[model samples]
Target chain A: MRHHLILRVVTKLLIGSIMLFALYVQFHGDYSPGGGFQAGVIMAVAFIIYGIVFSLQDVQRVLPPWLVHKLSALGVLVYAGTGVVSFFTGYGFLDYAALSPHHPVHGQHYGIILVELGVGITVTGVMITIYYAFTSRTPVMDDEAW
Target chain B: MLRTRSLFATVMLAGVFSLLSALLFVTLDAVDVAFTEAAVGAGISTVLMLGTLALTRRFESPPAHTPVIPLFVVLVTGAALVYGTLDMPYFGSATAPAQTHVAPDYISRTPHEIDVPNIVTAILASYRGYDTLGETAVVFTAAVGVLLLLSGLRRRRRKEEEDV
Candidate 1:
């Protein structure tokens, strides 16, 4: 599998570009056809492709299983924390206005970004985690097996 | 006639189905839906199915029992759905109850209030913030469940220095 010259080179070129596109989708989602979920999947695909081309062990070395597990929990906390902050500020739970009472619009922008980030992080973590989990148990497959 | 095919071929067919459905969504002007369909349905699912195929047998077992019950169920469900849709308003009808309500408010005020050019985003993240939060939580929960089932905590392998 590792000996495939084209797969390695093409994956190298495609991985960085995919991650970049994921970022673009995340931030520019407000004006585009994407958001956290789509971006998160794209980001995961970048790493998953790397794993498939390079090997699961190599990719996991870069993104350890432990870190991914922790991140899977953290994203929900980040999202819920925004609501908690708003609640403490004497506004409705998850209130965007609480972020900036004077400039409600700016507050909305900030709130949206924060929540989207939380979503993106969780999605990326979960997706990669699942991929790693599935691959870990499987025997190293020969290219000819397919 | 698509029976007894290799798992790879079956997955490829599914991927093609997703791409076709995504194209249909685009034609309906549901760009957001199309994007998701293309990305999640056509892209990630195909990969995941391939992964599963790698782990399991490549070919499906021939049906031992009659598929008549399942076929009848599917046909009934499909007919019910089509019957249900018969009374719905035509596509993009202004008088549709869904459009008559808060959509106009969200569309009209989004520029002044949220200042985001994309009203869909504004509505999804701001107006319907809680729902999105719930959806994210659902995704997180699903991940947690999968982790529990597939890969709970494992002892770090310190002895083997096998490089990836």
Candidate 2:
């Protein structure tokens, strides 16, 4: 019991720290050593840690499997939608310059941020989903033996 | 007791090697790569492998008949690859082909084109957007595969329930 408690506490601290760091990396990525990929991985690691300490079912409760699936799809939509939006705006696909012809740099920054957020969301969702799938018990075991 | 000691030693060795590789990546200014290697290779991989061992047995019976010739060929090939590394440029050398080619274009044009200081981000999202799309598709495909596999099991369970 003591060991479990210790593991729980340590995992929480690690998760919390990674989350805080992820945010820092996201906002400060332009001038820092971290960015979307790093932040995404860190966020995923936090949830994986949570899954390890608590039961996978408990983790699923917090982030349901269906929600994770939706989020994964939603992330791709977010990314692709941003690009498609640019295209409709008379720019080439993923052309941030045309996003705001008045201030192209600002448009570029905005577009990048949107895309990065998408990457983060998809990465985290998919990673957690993978963990969930791997940890789930096989259905065959559920059948009563004759 | 002796086996536990050896397992601990092996884990420590793997950890050290992973840390060293991460440091090497960092020194080469591949910060993104370094971060991933450090986090996944050193941190998560070791933890997951150890967790698997915990869930399963730590040891397995040795193979009754080892494939000595096949093992020897594999080892030789691996050694040759390592030996070939001697002809490669020194690690982190600026004049290396990796730095000399296209990198300068990426570094110089990124600011003017995308206006992002992080060239890696610019390249990943803008310059090589299609490649990124492919990568995302690959991930999506893997997720679909997992879902399909799991859903098949779910279908089997449903059939069993109906029969009962």
Candidate 3:
């Protein structure tokens, strides 16, 4: 990969745009065709492309396995915590009306955004974790083997 | 396509098939599903398959047994599936079970209840919050499973190396 100057440069250029597009898909999901799942996969693809082009160690340094593991669980907690918050507000589990006492519609928006964010986070974490696990193993074939 | 002995070609063909299905999804007005199929099914899975190929044999060995029974079984299943679809509602039929069910309620009420432009998001995130939560938990579980399996293998391999 080091010798492949063209691929390295192209990847460097594409990675930022890919990350940007992932964020766009994430935040714009409410109005667009994409959602947390698509955004999360796109985000993971950016890191993975970097890993494939540069090296696994390089990408791992940028996003450590420990951080990814914690993030994976944290997303589930965020989702569950949102439901618990509604419970505290005198509503049943996952009822968005409790999020906003005056305007239940506003609460729904808030709940949806928060939930989607949680979903995106968990998906991104899990995807990166899987990629790292697979790639970190001792390679049966070297770079030139392909 | 199946006749190709190269695993690499098979993986590439699978990605192509996924992309075609994504296009079909778009035509069916399932843009979100199409996006997912394109990204995960075609892009990521293709890359993952390539990685797997790197760790294994590139060419498939000839099967010891004939594939006639498997071929016959596949044909039977395909025919059954096509027959099943014969009774299905026409595409985009308004009175279809999916359109008649809670979908109508979600579509009608989402604008006032959730105030979001994307009704799918409203239903997935707020209306069906429990399902999404469960799905996230499933993703977390998958990650845990993969980590346990792969990481355990590495540790055992290291121990074997130490013994050697």
What DockQ score does model 2 reach against the true complex? 0.34
Candidate ordering by lDDT (highest first): 3, 1, 2
TM-score of each: 0.93, 0.82, 0.94
lDDT of 3 by residue, B1-164 (tens): 34888998999999999999999999999998999999999998898888778768899999999999999999999999999999999998989999998988898998887888988888888888899899999999999999998756678779999999
Candidate ranking under TM-score, highest first, comes to 3, 1, 2
Off by over 4 Å in 3: B153-164
True contacts kept of 1: 0.76
Docking class of 3: high
State each model's C-alpha RMSD to the native.
3.1, 5.0, 2.3
User: What is the C-alpha local distance difference test score of candidate 2?
Assistant: 0.73
- Per lDDT, the best of the predicted structures is 3
Q: Encode model 3's per-residue lDDT on A36-69: one tens digit a residue.
A: 8899899999999999888888898999888999
Ranking by DockQ: 3, 1, 2
Candidate 2 chain A weakest lDDT stretch, 10 residues: A137-146
Chain B TM-score against the true chain B, candidate 3 = 0.91
lDDT score of residue A134 within candidate 3: 79
Docking class of 2: acceptable
DockQ of each: 0.74, 0.34, 0.81
